[model samples]
Target: MNTKIIKLDINNKMYETITAKQGDTKSRFLLFNLLDGSIPFSLENRSVRVYAVKPDRTEVFNDLIITDAAKGYCILELTTQMLAVAGTVRLELMVIEEDKKLTSNIFYMDVKESINSEKAVVSTNEFTALMNGLAALSEYDIYKSNAKQVPGIKEEVSNLSSQLDNMITLKLLMDIDSTNYRINDFIMVDKITRLQNIYMANFLRNLRNGSPVTIACMGDSMTYGHDVNSEDKRSADTTPCDNGSRHSFTRASITYPESLQKYLNKIYKNNVTVINRGYSGDYVKKGMERWNKKHNANLTIIMYGTNDSRADYVPEEYRGNIDEYLKWYEQAIIREILWGKAVVIFTPPKLQSFGDLDVDTFANGLIQLCKKYNVPYIDTELFTINYNNINSDGVHFNGVGYEIFGMKSASVFVSENLLKPQYVKGGTKLLNRQTVDNFVVNGTYSYSATSGAYTPSELNNTGGSVLNLNPGSSITYSFYCEEDDMFVIPYIYTGADKIKISLDFGLKAPENSIDASIGKGATPLDNNKSSLEFTNSGTLLINKDEVFTNGVECLRIPTKGWHTLTLTNEHSQSTGGTLVINGIEFMNYDVFASYVNINKYYRQNYLKYTSHPILGDTASVSEIRIKPIDYLKLHPFYYLANTEYWRNPPLQLIITDYLKGSIIYTFTIGNNSDTTMFHGEKARLGAYTGGRTVSNITLDNDTREIVITFNSGLTNKSNLLLKLV
Candidate 1:
């Protein structure tokens, strides 16, 4: 395909205020379209070029990020030398194709001195981060001798170390925007927060199906789009329902909510009503009163704590005060729920700490409330990586900053496919697996491109052997955990049968290496070990019945982080079978309450393990990775069902009763059109906390579930296993 520029954007908006300064550091985006082609057709082609020309046609910022092309755009970082020369310059964006210059768009820039106390802190922080990142890359690069990289690292470290001294110099400098950058004690929060699929997901799904969606934005000034005059040092009025200063800095045309609406309509081809119910000083208690039934909505986005962070209230008994921050916050939340709306709370963007209340406390309180209410929210305070992108007042954001916030907030919907017809329902697509602290075996297995048939060990590289499975073929994994939680192992195995697979902890045992072509349970080289039987149809985990007697068990590892598990396929005599091995996942279970499982009968059919909350879809565990844990945090759950295979509508099962030995949950399998429930001959579960021995698994003649009764050890009562079988 030939090169094409479908669209172009600057700071994700048609208009953005950019400033150039003398002897300062800065960056701008000259991002454009042209995404559907090979790298050589665009990125590698030295495609676009940008220029900043003065009134006299003097070109400034000749240095641009044109040569740099990413997924869709370019990040133009200005040279310190370029920014040092300040002027009101015109920036022209263009595309170069086959020796021709094509104009994209242009904008005016107010190039002035931006090296004030506020900018200094921002610049210093960015510089420090860049330096640290480089240092890390250099230190971790196994082959650092390739280019004087080690020397470069030392020089950069020295330079960044020296820059730290200038932070004190900032205190003596003059002009500044509302300032707060505790570098010394600064905690790095997540730049993007993704959590459990909560209420809006359902509402969003309805919206994409051409159904109407109304989002209520309620909070204080920030939610109302508070904009401070950095130059004049004057604050806007707090009570204006619609004000110029509340929008893209002037005019309520493109405030965050407005921008959000624009974005939704553009993408969904349907109008999504975004009601702006923000007032200047709306704190928690006062905000709760506005949650009237008259203000109904499908989804509500509440961003409070701005006024509460600095509000005056009794301090001594604050924690126990009925009208304290969390008290009113909880009341407001329950109000929204009562109003029949799903809520998404934000950790009101940061502010300079005033006295007793800190943003962390405010933000964390919302998290605690979410758990209490079983709700969902954006963990903004802890996971926003755009600190340097904030507007003048560190507390509030302008359009550019708000634009990023809009996209990030919108990401939850976008990422979850809520803006489209629900296709491929449930489960976060494992497009790419996380290898953080993970192990991978390289170059030891067969691969396929047509089916995207992957091999996990291909990507994981913790200095291990590649996995090549067949009869008597197996590989072992060594992992370390910090806490004792039940975990499940999910794998992608295509077409195989009667291949005895065994799981062991820590110690290595006999090698039963076999070929992929064929082999049934191989002839005993030693003794008969209990193992899960694998078939192309699916796998049957080691039935504990034989496990306790034969000493071979299913794939459930319960131990501390410092542990190991070995998986081996035994040699076979009968025509074993041929199989393709792909990815295998290690995830812990946290949803101990109630959920459905793909019983052994359903295992061989159309479904793999889809993780749930408490054990986030991520490979990133919350507790005990680096060392033993004194504290722990759980993850949000994920939903999974063969949306395609099941012709029926979605099915939900709730726990009806729980006794000491037996607990009962309800479920309805199939599309509801058929009475047949799926059953698997073999199954591998992620986690389980019941009796070591199963006397029997009985399906209710009344409902649809194989009621399992647990007896013995784990008496936590809250440890319900949540993994695919």
Candidate 2:
């Protein structure tokens, strides 16, 4: 055998390409002396793996022979399969150690074709056997009779032979241990474990029982099904749409969640509903907020970290450290586990032409956390790095990529036994409750302006039409209210300048108005009284001090009838200022109050958990109460008073408390016609004092109310915090 040696430094680039003849397979060998700067990197007790990408996009994964481990030397004996391609092969060396792994810079291998090379022909034994069997069948009397009746039998037999050949070829290509050059070797799984499959016990049970299962696929744009369809596609330079910006472009039919649903239902023959709760351009922190709002899913698959890899995505304190940066994800996983719902985390693929964040390190950190918490995770880096999967933007995936992802995800669920129930916990009954509804009137809707004209501008962030209000113009919006005491909020976009706002055109007097600029309610402007003025700071500040940054409240509509609210831009014609109105949001006072209360509670108790000396850490005691209006606020999109959009019912609040073995938690509910009601039988009470038990569950049929009380006792230093789901 002919031998060739190549010395390559790990710190510098390799300018020379290793050249070999295409047909010189068995007699050719390449030896590599790996050096770190001026010193030879020790390879003792380490494994060196070679990764090569062939000219036809096929991949080769093989280990190199370590001839001198102490001297950092390895040898790669060229094979007929490796030298079959007569083009440049991109190769890299990965040295794996017990604690760490190091990869060398990518190098090239150019293989020249021989002058008189000829294509090699091969035949399989299976094909020969099948042909012999068919020949033998022709000698039988039954075969002769059938062949006389069917004139196209010969063609059909030929077609069957061709199909068999194709199938065999495909099976050979798919085999990971094939000595021949194969395609799709990059799609192989590196790790497989089912230790954390127990977390999905309840979800699996639901599927087995033929009960409806809701799976929430939550992440950024990838989970939102970006680039899967034509409408949502973007170029390399185009910025990804935010949460509500591209809601209309997202097609639920083609998303990965939908694909997963289709695959699962086809295999399991069960009812599975997958909702895409994906918000584009969102980091983990924002994802946590959105999930906290409403994640009433039996299983939640979270795939984030793509947008978080942007240069400015993470906080300064969280930069560089993967553990600190992924704190939000850790907390989210823990919350889901505590809520008794199954969770599957997906580490996003590395960016091809996008941001420069170290996704590999981040993914490794996530895997470590997943192992530590005993949570299942799907590492999508290897699955999506191919050119056929990623889109032109290099951040999102194409339809094929999404489909493959969905299929593989379904396969994982089946292969890992995640669909089999291990420990069945009784299902918690969801409460039936009525939530607040909201009405919105676009700026281009029926309205009259005095003095200057109202020209329609482009749509705003919420996808509502915007009307640019000319200086010195007063626009009066006449909208009817269904109930009394409904609050009206006018969405306005004001440029930097001091603008006078006059609200004296309504028939009824203004009850109260929040002056967001000053962060307080201005004195009520009586009907035909004075106007209020405030300066536009041009910065959106979301805080308790000023909740409505782009909108001002006109609280308390005295009657449930037709009402007109007017806003007059007091800027002179020559002053040159802009006041753009997007739309008006009219919500019931009680509903608005509830929305504020819920939002406030979320902000106060956000990621707040209770820890005891003996009881350990409990899930967040915060309540997850959100109405349709709240969800819409988080993911705003264009819609009028459509009942389907506005009437999506809110989730029932379920409070959980982890107490000491001897302590008992009592939840009292009054049996009043106008009070809150609950299903006493559905209440889940687990006592750790000795064994799990539901002590007392009382219900009042007349009042339609219920009270749940567990075994009573208390232990010192027991955490009594409660969590509302």
Candidate 3:
């Protein structure tokens, strides 16, 4: 006989559910998907214990995978291999009552193996409820709080409370004292709690409604609830005996989402489900992905972007990627909200002003974008501001922060406007006109095909036409003609996939005499690699060597599509350049550049950027070039000129400060396990060395870790070398 436990209501009393073998050789597997509720789990009298004897006087075997389920479900598989035919197996889903009475109920199953036939599909509601009942555990919290008031409830509460206390202690050590095992161990603690809450809420709600309900809690780590426990003994191991011991708050009973669920259920006068889908170190990019999983939820709340502003990417670039992320995220939220036009709430990162200008800028930008998208943006930041409260870390919040934030968001769902949309979806009539007002049209160059020929949207200083590539502004050229005629000029354009113009063209067309006339427009500097040649089917190459400050490359393109462009280092020198094109198309290509020349001081104060090193570092600048690989951009850090930053997606590079200059030190980083191609066309690291990928490089004599940092705010495009030693 196999041991099994199930839970089902018997005359409105809590009972541990059990399944018995009914004229069967073996017991089958039982799985349950519980809904959101207050009680952690319901089990009465330890109903899942091993039996000394089975029906027909046979031995019993117990096998179970008893952890919280991934979703709102639990599974129980049993085998009767050790039991005699017609053996009896007994179990029940049970819960303790206020009167200190044990409850038990038999678990039932309807398994009918059949061939193809017109059979009605069985519903999963009843099966899920029974399974949830068996696995129900005590909400040690509720038991502890109320036990003091009730006489004779001490021993039961102590036993249940001790188990939770031990679990809480273990969870605390799992976080701060990572040396005991691995850092990943503590991550599962939150995951388990999330599942427990979802299961408890669903199971209790099922009993209340006489049906099943699904709950989901969606957001980031804050939504996951991070607490530092003071009672955890394990944290002591990480510190020295001489260090004074201190108590910290553990993550055991910290439950913001559960608190919200409880509030909602009480307010609604019925059972409501809640699931925590919060990830530890996730942003909007990750939050959107997790929410896409199939779940039965009439509502969802999205909280994200608290972690994105800290990323190493440039502020402008980060905003660009975030823009695309939000577009997709908004669409997904709309689908969920409109599922019967269900209610949805979008919460922004709470407003806590960081000294960094970039973070504030990014957050404000996101807030504005959310307003335009019509997603309800909850102002979490305002709570802290209004209450004059502060968390010790100056980054995260205290208990007050959680309480205020949770209440404000919950209030949105309670309001009558929960399902109402302020503006209709796809209603962009106002946005388009608003954008046009701020467009500030620079110059419009139309291609009429009247003179020789020109690319669509081509702009130049000739034929009485002019368009300026301002310091931070650009204009698009539209194609109105149908002919495939080509246009030529004295500049080049590089897209995400390939280069439109190469430097070798000027050398090939000697009669064009573009180089001789360079002084008249753009002169060649000593650091600028002016030498030009052709490779790979007349592909052009430009090599910038020993260039420490700034450089520029000019070329002409008469064709379109994708082209291959390469740049290799001649000698270590910090360098990068802006590509100038005469008759090229500019659509989705966005160019961003920045590097710090150690010699340049800003207002006599040293700049501080964690992502990159300051000026006057040992790593000298080397080679830098942009190439097309995919529709996305790929920046490969390199040093050696001959080395190739293969136009493959997902290119990796290792930049280090060695051999004095970036020309001879910088190299590409590759791993044998890296086979997946990147989604973008090319990779461009602004402050980069030439084409040299090395296995290891020594920095500052003591063998340091080599890593390249791309600093976007710097005007010099100088690569920063960080030592991981």
Candidate 4:
């Protein structure tokens, strides 16, 4: 078979050509297609390693695949999907035979001269002129080195050139109606003039404030705005900006940051200055480099890490790079601010993984960085499943993708108060500025409770105790304060699990200026009333009663010689108006809870040892802690499940109870999901008496149990033993 490499342009014009016979396919062939005035080609594999002799360096990027339908042979199409790329795309394709061996049929075809339409020819000429003009203006590249010091501005120039290519590509794709075309042309000139005015005004403002705000959108190909639409649905070449340099992937008009500014202006009514510092193929390291340029930003969002692992950057190494950069990033951003303050950071959206393990490592690393640096971060990891919602490429977001992204990141900034709109009316829309419930309190209040409002002092130790007694009892609190501001009372912890307090306040009369009602449990209530009376229907008991606000207000509990008084709310839930106490005078031994094993089950009776419960096996717990205490020490015989056949090993049991609350404990297991069958008896679990032993708890042949002696200097009420068979 004969082989050939053809250089084709958008107008069907050919530049350079290479023709080969069947012998040339033995090795890979490098081809360059001159589209319009730019050279571009496709790489056949997941990644292509390219070595540019001019730069004397080797670089690798994800490859774009193309196929030759005209012939039976498979080809890699490296077409520009967007307008950000210009000039020529250097491509290399390695073809292999069906026998898993190399082929020797390299071919080159020239298709650039085949201009089929007048429009195509005009576009090609225009693109050619633009490319030649750009090449004439700059002779040197500054972004050539990865050295510590600021490299030359070649990288910056390259970045700008890429962006221009992107803009041209978008302009070419846009449907320019004759009338609208002229209108847009006028608008473009106006926009350019407006940009100059805005830049000058911004410069003056920065001069007065002595600090300039720098905003950047950093991410992978998506952040740079890659492919969106294909000219022909069945073209097989779906890449953006396929045959034009002026229309490249990093164009300004289609990029998220560029689009976001327009959105911000519509929303804010005033143009907010934003600098598009986005670059294609940027990862965490690239993000750090951009930040290092000393750009003053009041709010800087970091959008990356999507390609970090895909590009094969190890998590730990990526983490280390990020950690180091964060230190400098924080310091630099703060220094660039009007006052020294850290810039806002946003983690990149999740990437589609061939498997779960891929994205997990990256997600965990991002979380760790955010937590350690105390930087406010967004949760883009959770939004990856609906990734197609915001992304065009499984990795990069499209226009809609960037739209959602901008709205989300902006929401986060607003919620964190990192960004505040000029004016917002009352309602949920305006209320979104706060992430947590701290809007009115200007960094002064400790935020004692979850209810944005503070609790009353009565139940809390803020002043005096309203109800402080023993077990199984309750008390009521009453007051006659005028209702002006919203009243919120939070039940504080008087003791651990020892108390369960219910507080409900009420109005004296319906016509009595205010209407008061009780809520279900700890739900916040808006006590808008005059003379309000709150009643707790049970006697006050230790561990059962809840303390109200701890520090915000002063309480006036019954100072009239504290004689178990019960006030009536006159209206409430669970109301018998009978004050009862349900408190344990002394902590009972039966009540002490302990997590004995890891990845196994233990009977709550004898604390017996076994691979699993005598009856059956439960679930597995991988990484767990019996917090406030350790579990492995309590149960030593427990081992990791079957080394060979490991299913979901029973690691911990998630215990959830409505009244008793919920707790999880790591149990013990001897083998993994290796199917094991048991035929007979189990051990007995009994309490010990004297120094020898006492109770004989027997287990039938079918029953599972383990007997153990409770040796304690303290009294034994009820002991729970997990007997694994």
Clashes of each: 42, 1, 85, 129
Task: Give the lDDT of residue 686 in candidate 4.
Answer: 38
Local accuracy by lDDT, each model: 0.40, 0.49, 0.33, 0.31
Question: Model 2 residue 646 lDDT?
Answer: 29
In terms of TM-score, the best-performing candidate is: 1
Candidate 2 at 237: error in angstroms? 22
Give the lowest summed-lDDT range of ten residues in model 2.
Answer: 428-437
Comparing 1 with 4 on TM-score, the higher-scoring candidate is 1
**Model 3: runs farther than 4 Å from truth?**
1-215, 228-252, 290-292, 312-321, 334-343, 351-374, 388-392, 417-725
The digit string of per-residue lDDT tens for model 2 on 640-713 reads: 22233223222222333343243333333322323333333344445544422334433323312233333442
lDDT of 4 by residue, 120-157 (tens): 21111112112423223211111113322324323333
- Deviation (Å) of 291 in candidate 1: 6.0
The digit string of per-residue lDDT tens for model 1 on 401-504 reads: 55545544543443232222112111212222222222222112332333234333444453222234555443333233333333334343433455444333
Q: Which consecutive 10 residues in model 1 have the weakest lDDT in total?
A: 624-633
Estimate the TM-score of every prediction.
0.30, 0.29, 0.25, 0.26
Q: Looking at candidate 4, what is the lDDT of residue 567? A: 21
Kindly report which residue pairs in candidate 2 clash with one another.
661-689
Task: Give the residue spans of candidate 4 off by over 4 A.
Answer: 1-214, 228-253, 287-292, 312-341, 353-356, 382-390, 415-725
